[model samples]
Structures are given as C-alpha cells and as structure tokens.
Target: MTGERGSEQGSPVRNGAGPGQEGRQPPVIAIVGPTGSGKSDLAVRMALELDGEIINADSMQFYRGMDIGTAKITAEERKGVPHHLLDTLDVTDEASVSDFQRESRAAIADIHRRGRRAILAGGSGLYIRAALDVLEFPGTEPAIRQRLEHDLEVSGLAPLRTRLELVDPVSAARLGDARRVVRALEVHELTGRPFSSFMPVREYFQPAVQIGLEVDRELLRERLAARVHRMVSSGLLDEVRRLDSLGLRRGRTASRALGYAQFLRVLDGEADEEQAAEETIVATRQFARRQLTWFRADPRIHWLDWQDPDLVAKALTLCG
Candidate 1:
C-alpha cells in the first residue's frame, strides 16, 4: 500500500486546522479537463478569486524542461500565485503516481495550514485521482517487474496481454500499453490479486470539489490540432532538442510524451517537422477523447462548458 494515506498519518485538515477550525476550512478545489480546454487559466482565475494556490496534477508538467510541449503555465500566467509541484522532476526522471500522492498531499496540507484553498489542476486522470481520492498503490517488486519487462521485450505485448486477460479481464480490457501490461502482470504475480482490485473507488480522501470542463468533441479536436501547431511555431522542437540532449530519450515516461515522442522522430530524420506535427495532433486528439471519457465517469464532478462566460462563478458555486 504505497500510495495509502493511512489513518495513522492523520487527515490533511488534522495537521493544518483543528476541529474548531475545520468548519471554516475551504474544500480542496480541482479543475480538470482535456488538453487545450483552458484548465490552467481557469485554475489561475479561481485561485485569484478564492485566495488559493494551485497543485499541478499534470504528470508531464512535473518535468523541469518539458514546458512547451506540456503547455506548462508561464510565470506571468500564474499571476503571482504560488504554484506547487511544477518542474519538480528532471526530464530524465520517471513520474511516479505514489510519489505524487505523497508530495501533493503534503502540499495540500501546507496550503490548508495557511488557510488558503488548494486548487488541483491538470488533465492527467490517474494523477488527479491520486491527489484527491482514497487511492492505494500496490508496492512494486523489482525482480518480478524486471522479469515481466524482459518477457514483454522478448515475447511482445500480445502474449503478456493474453496472460493478463486470463487473470484480470477488467484490467486487460482497460490497459492499452506494454508498460502497464507489464505492471499489471507484476502486481498479480506479487500479490496474487487482479490489478483491477486496486483501482480507486469514487471516494474522496478529504473535503473536495471537482469541476470538469466540458467542450464539444469536434471543437476540442480543432483546438488541440491548432494548439499543436502553435507549439511547433513557439519553439516546441527546440525545447525537445534541448531536453533530448539532457537525456530525455533515456527517461521511460518523458520520452513517450505526446509531442516529444513525435518530435524525436523528426530529430532522427525519420520524419519532418510537418509530419511530426500532424502525427502529434492526431495523438493529442485521441488523448483528449480518453481524458473526457475518464472524467465523465465520475458522477461527483460538476461539468461546466469550457466557453461559458460565467464559468468561474459557476465553479465557485460548486466549490461552496
């Protein structure tokens, strides 16, 4: 139980505010949405209005040199609000959900201690859940993990996927990557339980409100495509090159990021910038669709139209 914020560890409010002050504490506010859906801007606006700080839940934004492709908020865009957890990891480091859970919970507790709202913002579904939900992470056994990874490298994903399907059909249906397939098999072998058994239920770890940004599917596709093009025009390739030189390619998670992955091909002379941009656009749109599906499944989220003129006010109402 690596990600478990156990009862013995105490609640976020317990360390920050006493029982008498609990009634006065503001609920943790989370702004969640797909890429290019204005989550960061809305988070900033809400922070300004609510006297709050932002804790980034975007896994990509954790990397120090991954700004352009991840659309990390500019210093000016943060508007002097103290943002937590951005640029905390090197591009060569793999982002871990359990580690994020511990760090983000600590940040949230600190924000509450200062009596300011903690606004969790980003599009990463699992990272967001790890921050706000009663989630538990299974401990990793390196030997088993390495063996499964070696199997994946030698036998490929199909054989491993089939093995997972036999033991855990739910996770087999849900997971779509070789890395995750390996992780699922590793978990099962270590614990003798299906990996899906560890999935977080829709239970909040603390008083929290989730505001989801809803956008028209076609409009979001157009926005994502245009955003990728803008990233290209705004030196995304140069940023990728800089990070690549810093061993970005060696990082398991950072190297596979949307624009970074496609752009790496361009650097290798396999594809030109235009082809990379188009491919990135396609991949980004597909990612957005998956994000929408994940966020939509949570009944607790209050959905707001991304273009609503009174969006901030509506979100504030939900927070209250």
Candidate 2:
C-alpha cells in the first residue's frame, strides 16, 4: 500500500463502458476495497458473469487454516468458479509482496491461458499492485538482513523504528510489523535510497482495469463491528486455538493478524474472550481505515458505491 502509486483524478465508471469490448485486448479486472466492504462477493458476481477465474490479492487469505479470522470465502461460496492463491501458504510461512507478485502473475497468466477472464480481488493494496503494476522490489543482502534481525532481537523495534523514521518515514509509517520495518530499513541500508523512492510510477506492468468499492464511513464502522462479533460467535477463538498448536505464534505475519493476535492475549489469561473480540473489532476497524486511505490515494480505480442496487450489473458493464 505504501509503495503503490496512482492518479488522484479517478472517477466512477459511467454507462460509457466498453460494452462491446471483448477479446480485443483482454483486461485484467481488479476488485479492491476496504475490509468487510463485500469486495469478495462483488468479485464472485463479476467472475460468474464474465466467465472469469479469480486470483487472490488479499495477503491474509493466503494462509492455510486461517479461514474464519481472515473471513476467507468458503469453497461452496466460490460458486464453482475457480479460485487461485487461497490457502497456498502455511501459517508459519512468511509472505512478501514480491513473492506474491510473482505467484499471482503466474496465476493470472494461467487463467488467461485457459481463456477465462482474470479477476484480481482483495483489499491488500500493495499485493494488488505487485500483481498488476510495474513495481520492483529492492534486492536483499543476507548479511544486512541478518544484522537487522539481530538488532531487532537485541534492542526491540523502537530503536530500529526510530532509524526507519529518520531514513524512510513513509515506509516507517506504513509498516507496523517488525519484519516489514526491518526490511524497509535494510532496503535503505542496501540502496542508499528511501524505500518509498522505489515505488512504481503510476503505470501498470500489465493492462488492467481496477474497480473500487466505497462505503459510507459511519455505516462501515457499524458493519465492521457486527462482522467482528459474528467472527467471534462463529468460532474465531477455536480457530486460533487450533492454529496456535501448529506454531502460529511463531509465524511472523499470522501471529500479528487482527483477531489472532488479540485472542492470543485472551488465551494467555491476559484478557477475556469478550474483551478480545472487542479489541479485534477496534483493530479491524483501524485496518479498514488504512485500507480505505490506501485505495483512496489511487485515482485510477473506478469507484462504485458499495451498496448500489445495480452494483454487479454496473461492474459487468464496466468490464464489458
């Protein structure tokens, strides 16, 4: 999200979409939005209508056995439309946007090869960009990475975070996780440039169409709270408990997930489940805000009202 770039002049799609446009130069359709904004449902509808297969851009949904917490779409919910990149990683595996870019593009290529429209869907802005934009990841040096990792362990993130703020404040603000923070710091150390400076200039690596979903902020907050409550009632705690035995706590990214992290405190006797659920709701809401902020910066995305009655029909028209 931090490194992603786009125009600020993005306007909503009108009835003047390419209705007769098909197969001339096939476009990769990207569905993006804030969490709990129904991006997945909309994507499924689009995929169904367009004879498309989906390539996931949601980073959390990549992990296996992370269904409930991440709100991963169930197989039945997939409606027999083929989906790529879900449950492809173990909870213990670390995921980088670079790796995601590589894998997702491959999936997209395969979907195209099969003569199906490739629908990219998720709220992870950078992952989506990595898959579709001309973004380049900074090369890594093992020794530098090792040193940063050592520093992180010995002194904790505060000092390293301070350094990142001084050297690459943009990356520093966008990255809350220690792993990403350390990587950003390493990039600065290795390249003598701010991590953000390597961001993609507003250009796509592949021709693509981006559709954005926007929700009223107040309504979204209420919806997010209710969704988190539903997650708890639907066995998010039990899911975490099962994952913890599989070394989920050791998983850098998985351990830091909104619900999983808060519930970890509950499991440790530091909080109650209700309190944990409340914390999860608050954290998820904050995450949704960040997501909105990230997508809002990109003006190329055709914005659509999330609750529009003709949302699917309008989206298909845009694709057409």
Candidate 3:
C-alpha cells in the first residue's frame, strides 16, 4: 500500500486496495522493543508524523505514580501527543492482560473514530501479543479463587504447582515457575478447561504492522545502567517506600519490579545504594535479554536498527 504524505494532524492518504478484499482491516502500527530502547520516543515521533495516537502496551507503566522506575514518558516528553493506558491505575490494583486488551481495543477504536492511526508501543511482549492475538483465558470462579488464595496462603505455591501438574500437565509444563504455576492452577480450578486450552492462535486484529527497535548489545547495556542510575537519583527509593506504605511488600509482583526490588533490598538493610543500583542494572539487563528472546521468536515483527538516523521513515515504510 502507498499513500500521500500528510501532515501530523490529518489522516494518512491511502492508495491501494481497500480493506476486506483479503479479509484485512485498516492497518495499525505497533512499536516494540526492549526496555530503554527509545520505543516511546519513536512512537511519539510517529504519532506526530503519521496522525497517530499511542496506546501503551507496557505492563508496569499502567500503575499510577510509577513514573521514574517505569521510565514513563512525562507530559513534556509527549509534546502534546495523546497517549493512552499509562498511569491509569493504582499500584495496589491488579491489572491483567485481559484488562490491557480491553482498554487497548477501546483506545484503538477511538483513534480510528478520529480518523487517525493507533500506535501500540512498549517493551511488554505479552501485552502486545495479547492485544494482537485472539487469546482468551477461561473465566475464574470467585469461590475457586478464594479457595486458591487460601491454599496459597496456607501451603504456598509448591502444592498448587503439583495440583496443576495433575490437572493440566500441558499448562503446568509451560508454567513451571512458582508464580505462573499458581495462576495456571487457579484458572484450572476456577474454570473447567485447562489454561493452555484457552490460548487462541488466531489473529485478533486486521492489517497490523509490527516494528521492533534494535540496538547494539553493548549500547543497550550501557543505556540500561545509566537509566538505573538516573532512576536512583530521581527518587526511585522514595517511590518504592511510598508503594511499600501502600502494603506492597517485598517479593510480591509490584515490589519485585526491577528498581523497586532493588530499593526494597536496600530498605531491608540487605544492600547499600551502590550495590542496589548495580543489582538493579544487572536485573534490568537480564530482563531486556528475555524480551529480546521473546521478540525474536515472533516472526511477524520487522526489526529496525535504533541507531539509524532515519528510523521514522523506515518505520513508516514498514507500516505501509
């Protein structure tokens, strides 16, 4: 498809076969990459140039008051571009992929209503995949959820993992970790079907284009280190302390976030500032590596080198 170059405020001009000939819908663009890879900045630029609104796909950025640690874009950074799904919930609230999918769909629909493109942007592969694929999980029974919570509190995750392995070995095999195992077992007990059975392989959206940012490993590592240091300098410890006061204790999902976890260790007197920052950097690097692994496995994404000066043009071409 080819189109006229339009201004940022106007709709993109289209010059190709219209939607529906091949069961395709209007194209939506997504910018995905490892954390600290400038995905948001690129998304903002694309939005300004392509008449798009950014829908955040990052999991952590959903929580309110998690700006510094999450590397959340500030108002000034957005440059008047409208962004959706960031800082929309309290840290105490549990936001899941289902919630993200629902909210993102609404945001995309709104963008389409405005005659603009929707730009999905973040490092969270699971959230992006959940939004793009028609993957649904079985409903959970309240009573079963309560029971599972009680069991988890009483016996911890090992028994839950064992139970899940017995009920749904496929899901259990895929979710052998303590956190995932508990969730899988909870879903199994709540709904009749295995968790794995709910995973749909069909496309959820139509005519979507995925663009991944690529950076040199050494440069990424250096940038991550600097980012962690900046977070430390920018009151990340204070932020963790506030969240801790909200009853988000250590080792829970919220507390285990990269910067927050390190600060929690420092709060427990387990580490010094230097040690905490170093450990946070290391953990973030490891997390980025995992993101790369996940993104690499997805064949649909087109990778663009972040170092390229004309990345926006390359991304726009890819979107076309």
- Best-performing candidate as measured by TM-score: 1
Q: Give the winner by lDDT: 1 or 3.
A: 1
Tens digits of per-residue lDDT for model 2 on 1-97?
1111111111111111144333344789999999999999999988998899999889889889999999999998999989988888777877667
Per-residue lDDT over 31-120 for candidate 1, one digit per residue giving the tens place of the 0 to 100 score = 998888999999999999989999999988988889899989999999999999998877777777777877898899899989898999
Q: What are the lDDT scores of the predictions, listed in order?
A: 0.86, 0.83, 0.77
Q: Estimate the overall C-alpha local distance difference test score of candidate 2.
A: 0.83
The residue pairs that clash in candidate 1, if any, are: none
TM-score of 3: 0.86
Q: What lDDT tens digits, residue by residue, belong to model 3 across residues 1-320?
A: 01111101112112222366225335778898899899999999999998889999987887778888999999999999999988776666565666666668778767877889899998888778766775654554456666777888899887887788889989877875565565576666666667787664646455688999988999999999999999889898898888888765632345667888788888899998899999999999999999999899888889999989999999988877
Candidate 1: residue 219 lDDT (0-100): 89
Q: Give the lowest summed-lDDT range of ten residues in model 1.
A: 6-15
TM values, all candidates: 0.89, 0.85, 0.86
Candidate 2, pairs of clashing residues: 10-299, 18-320
